[model samples]
Target: MRSPAAANPAPHLHLAELNSFPPPRSCLPFLVRRAETALRRRAHCHSSSRRSTQNQLHSLQIPGRISHGNPPPPPTRRVILLLLLVVVLGAMGNSIYKFLCGVCSDLSDAAFQPHGAHASVAALGRDILEFQRTKQVPEGLSRHVVSSPAAQANWYKKLQVAWKKARPAPTTPEEAGRLVVLTLKNHQKADVDGLLAFYGLPHPNEAGSAPPPAAGHHAPPAQHSAPAHKPQGVKFELHTLPVDAKAVADGDTVTVYVDTNDAPSEIKKAAAERTKARAARNYPTADALQKTIAAAGYRMVPNAKGVEVLAKKYRIRLSGIDAPESAMPYGKEATEALLKLVEGKCLTVHVYNTDRYGRSVGDLHVGGVFVQEQMLKKGFAWHYTAYDKRPELAKWQSQAQAARKGLWAASKPQEPWEYRKAKRNGNA
Candidate 1:
C-alpha cells in the first residue's frame, strides 16, 4: 500500500504549483483543477473527522449543533455593540431619504397642507355668507333699511297700518310727501319712529303734546294753500280698492273691488305709452323698468294715467296730466313731457268727486304751478269734454292751435276725437 503522504500527493502538488506558478501562460485551467481536487479532499477529510467527533460528543452527551434543547449563548458586549451600530446606520439612511423627498416638493403648494388655513379666514368666510343671506329679499318688499330686515319690515308694516288708520286714503304726491315729511320731521327715540317718518306719518307727540301754533308760525300746508286758494269740492283721502272684487276681510286689511270700469280708455293707453317712452329714452328697453314696476307690485287701471295701485287697498293717481285721457298719436311724447316736469319731484292734487268713468277729477299742481293748466298751455293735452269743462278750454285750444303745439303740430291738425274715428275706420 502506498504511504499516507503519497495518497495525499495531490495536496502537496497543489501547494507546489501555487508557490511556483507564473502569471497565466495558459496554465490557469490546470492549476485550478489541481486546487479544486485538493480542496475536495480536504473537505472529505474534515467531514469524516467531524462525523467521528460528533459521535464521540454524542456518547459523552457534550452539546455541539444548535437545537431548542441546547442553543448557543448570546454574544458578548462587544459583538452586541457592533450589531446595534449597524441597525442605527440603517435607520439614519432611511430618515435621510424621507427628508430629501419632503424638500423636493413644491413650496407654492404648502398652503394645501392639512392644517394650513388660519382660523380668522374661516370666521370671515362665515360672516360674508351671512351678510349675503341678509341682503336677499322677495319682490315688492320695501324696507326702512335702518337696521335688520325683520326689524325694518316690521316697522314699515306697523307704520303703514297706523297711516291707514289715521288717514282714510292717499292722494297727491304732495299730500303723501307731507305725510312722509311730517313723520320724518318728528323726532322719536326708536328706529321705527324714523321709518314712520319715511312714510310721512305725524308723530303722536305732534298730535297730542306739541305746543300750539303761536302768532303767525303756522304749520306749512302739504296741499293747497289752507283751502283759501284751493278749488271748491276737491279733497284728498286714502283710497283702498282691490283689483279683485271679492275677498274676505281679516284684521285691519280688507279687500274690496277696484272700480275701473268707468275709467277712461285713453288714460290707460297713455300710461302704457308713457312707460314705453320712458324706457326708450332712459334705457335700452322697458324690460328693466317693467321688471322694477312688477317687482314693486304696481298695477294699472282704467281711466287712470300712471296709476300704481295695491288693488283697491291703495291707488295712486298721478297728480298731473302728461298726456290726454286717451292715448293720442303723441301720447308718448306728452307722457315724456309730464315725466320730465314731475319726475323725482313733489306735486299736489286737488281731487274732485269720482267722474262717471270712476276717475278722480283733479287739478294738479307742481311747484305752485297748475300742472293741468301748464300742460294745456304747452299744448300737450286737450281739455276732455266730459272731464275738463274749465272756462279756459276754448281759449287754451285757440292758443294751442295758434302755437302749433301737441297734436296741432300736424300739417292738418286733426282733433283727438276725429283721429280716433279715422283710426277706427282704418283711414288715419
Candidate 2:
C-alpha cells in the first residue's frame, strides 16, 4: 500500500492545488480593469498613428521629405490644410480676374475706335487745313493715312524731301500753291486736267478752237466774227466754242471737256455732243466711263455755302456766293438746300479765275437755271461782292435781304469771312 499510494499522492496533490486558488478576486472587476487598460493602450496607439499620418502630410507639403518624428496635433493640421486650400483658391481667382480684364479692354478699344481708312482721310483734311493756316507743313501728315506706321513715316519723309527740293521752300501763298500743285502732280499721279480744274487754272485746251492753223495750214473761214458779247446784264452766256460737261464739282463749279464737238446750233446740244465725243475718246465704253468716274479724286463735299470738289489730291471751292460756315446757325440748312438743287443735275461751268487757296472760282448752270442766282434768290447764300461785282447778283441779294432769308433771318448775321477770322483768333 505505501509504495503504490506514494506515487499516486503526487498526482492527487497537483489536482487539489489546481482546484483551490480562491476564486481569483471577483472576475467582473478584474475584467473591467483589463478592459480599461486595453482601451488606454489602444488610445495611445491611435494617437501615435494620427501623429505619424500628420507628419507624413506635413512632409508632403514641405517640398521633398518623409518625417519619422511626431507632427503637429490634429487641430493644427486641419488649420494648415484649410489655409492652403484658401490660398490656392485665391491665386486661381486672381489669375481669372486679370484675364477677364484684358479681354474687356480689347473689346472696348475695338468698339469705340474708327476704322483706319476713315481716320486717315479725316487726318489728311485736318493736316491740309493746318498747313494752310500756319504756312508750315506738319511732320506727320501721313501718319494715319496708311495702315502701317512705318509706311506712313516713309511716305511722310518722302513728301517732305520732295517739298524741300521743289524750288527752295515756299515763301508766299502763290509759291505754296505752286509747291502743292507740283507735289500733287508728282507724288499723287493726278490727271493734269483734273488738277487744273481743282486749282481754277485755265485748261490749256479750254478754248477748244481748232489748233491755230498749224503753222501755214489754211484755216476754215471764221464762224461769223465771233458772236458779239450780249449786253452786260445777261443772266448767263454760252461760249460758241464747243465744250463738254465733264463733272459737277460743286454748286458753282463744274469740269468741262477741253475740246470741241460737231453739233448743230443750240449751246446745250453742242455741249452734249462734245461731252459724248470726249467720253468716246477718253472712256470709250460705259464701263470705262464708270471706272474713270470711280477713279476720280475729286468727290463732292457738302459745305455750308455750296460744295467742294475734293479731288484725289486737291480741293475746289465754288464761286459767286458765300454761305455761313458749318459752326454757324442755318449753315447746315444752306448746305442741304444746295445739295437738293444740284446733287444729281448735269451742269455747265464757266471758269473765271483761281483763288489764293487754289480753288476754282466758276459759275455753274443747269440748262437755263443759274445756280448762284438761284441760291441767292432762295436766301441760302450771300453775294460775294469782293470778287463778284455783277449787278444782277447784288439785286438778288437785296431781294433775299428784303425777305429776311436764311442767314438774313438772324438779327445781325455774320459774314463767312469774318466768322472764319473770329474762329482763327479763338474769339468765336
Top model number, TM-score: 2
Worst 10 residues of 1 by lDDT: 245-254
Q: Count the backbone clashes (under 3 Å) in each candidate.
A: 21, 4
User: Cα RMSD to native, each candidate?
Assistant: 25.7, 23.4
The local distance difference test score of model 2 is 0.45
C-alpha lDDT score of every prediction, in listed order: 0.43, 0.45
Task: Please provide, for model 2 over 59-129, each residue's C-alpha lDDT reduced to its tens digit, 9 standing for 90 to 100.
Answer: 22321223346666699889999999999999999889977644322222222222442332223334434
Q: What ranges in model 2 sit over 4 Å off?
A: 1-316
lDDT of 1 by residue, 1-428 (tens): 84332334454563433444453636645654555566566657777544443333233222244223645556786699889999999999888996664432322322112133222222222222333345433322233223455644443333333333333233332343344334433322333233322233222323333334334322221112112256556676332221222221111111222334343444445446646666568543444544543344343432122245322223233332224433456665665555544432233445666545445555544333445555667777666655455677657766887988876788864455567678789986
